[model samples]
Target: MITTPEHDERMAKMTFASVYPHYLTKVEKKGRSKEELHQVIEWLTGFDDKKLQDLINEKATFETFFQQARLHPNANLITGVICGYRIEDIETPLTRQVRYLDKLVDELAKGRKMEKIIRGQ
Candidate 1:
């Protein structure tokens, strides 16, 4: 499916905080812990507990959230189909980053080991 620029725009404008709870519920319902979820996010975005909370409290948009992120060096290693799009094939940087995060969380929820999710530390 071609992602129209408007679609990307809406996705970019999505609030990270608004979507966080859903992600948390998905993982937790699958027997994962919040720490594990946070670990996955931190690995992708480099935001520790406080920073993450601050962003959440501020209801940061995906654009603002990523703008503040110092992405992991191995973030490119995160590649797969997620949300119906191939992660590596995504042309928009923000969209790719979002899918990288989604793919990581999906892996965690599926019980993949943390070492593998973070690309072996």
Candidate 2:
């Protein structure tokens, strides 16, 4: 895993004019949009203008942007496709809520299993 400091440093050195084409290439590969890219930045940095400017100005690395994007609420669908799982169309608010809730439950179950193993139970 790349450390956050290294990630930030690389991001700081990027120039968008040079990186935009590559960024668009990744977006095409992922079947996402420029809007999604902006949304990911907004989500990751709490919509900080300075941070957004830095990301845009530096031609941020796709790896860093992709990692940040995955933290967005819609990222589960992207991950599903990447992992060879079927992506569900969670268009409705209810469906979205349930999906997130299910993810939360799964995480809790994994935490419980980890705790048991750590405790030698």
- Candidate with the greatest lDDT versus the true structure: 1
Q: For residue 105, what is the lDDT in candidate 1?
A: 88
Can you write out model 1's per-residue Cα lDDT over 71-117, one digit (the tens) per residue? 99999999879988988898889988888999998999999998999
Give TM-scores for every candidate, taking all chains together and pairing residue i with residue i.
0.96, 0.30
RMSD of 1: 1.1
Model 1: how far residue 52 lies from native, Å: 0.6
- The top-ranked prediction according to TM-score is 1
Segments of candidate 2 deviating more than 4 angstroms: 1-12, 48-121
lDDT of 2: 0.40
Estimate candidate 1's alpha-carbon lDDT, on a 0 to 1 scale: 0.93
